[model samples]
Target: MELTPRLAGMVALLAFLPVVAFGVFRTWWAGAITLVNVVIIAVSLYLLMSPTESEAHAAHGDDVESAGDEAL
Candidate 1:
């Protein structure tokens, strides 16, 4: 199965839920930090998985077809 951005984020969030739960049992601040970490990780995964503008265009066969267009 391919790991898309949404899937990766879901996996990361699930993996971190336990840490947040256990952290909450210890202290509120610990739980808060873990929650923040989860958000950051999810966002990072999405950004990393998604293609950039040029990459997206290239993948869709939207790139200039002619070699001469490369210089522009």
Candidate 2:
């Protein structure tokens, strides 16, 4: 099975959430910062790993609908 960009982001977020929660429960402001950092990282990874419009179209060949879905 292929590991998509969305899944990569999800996995990163899952690991980061616990760290953020730990910091928050400890009453540290660092938790909020960690949350933001994690979000940024996840977004970066997703965008970087995801297929471009042209790439998606090329990969799918005649399947325009699938390419459009991937673009979303």
Candidate 3:
């Protein structure tokens, strides 16, 4: 099944909800959920930190001076 970004984020959060609930209720699943959440958060952060190809190109081009003066 094709998953949209919103759906994926929801699924990620939902996956931890049970554990959070269990932890709040003082059940054995507290640590398990915390660990899972940590892993998911780490992965999310990694994805966010990674740059796209266009961003890299723009960064490289940004320092190039314009040639408008040559047209005069």
Alpha-carbon TM-score of each model against the true structure = 0.75, 0.64, 0.38
lDDT of 2 by residue, 1-72 (tens): 788998898887896768667786875777767777888988999999998988866766776677577678
Q: Measured by TM-score, how close is model 3 to the native structure?
A: 0.38
lDDT of 1 by residue, 11-43 (tens): 878867687676867888887787788889889
Error of 3 at 3 (Å): 30
What C-alpha lDDT do the candidate models reach, one value each?
A: 0.78, 0.80, 0.62
lDDT of prediction 2? 0.80
Predicted candidate 3 versus true structure: per-residue lDDT over 44-70, tens digit per residue: 955665667767766665443533432
Output the better candidate (1/3) by TM-score. Answer: 1
Count: clashes, candidate 3: 0
How many residue pairs collide in each prediction? 0, 0, 0
- Structure candidate 1, residue pairs in collision: none
lDDT of 1: 0.78
Clash list (residue pairs), candidate 2: none
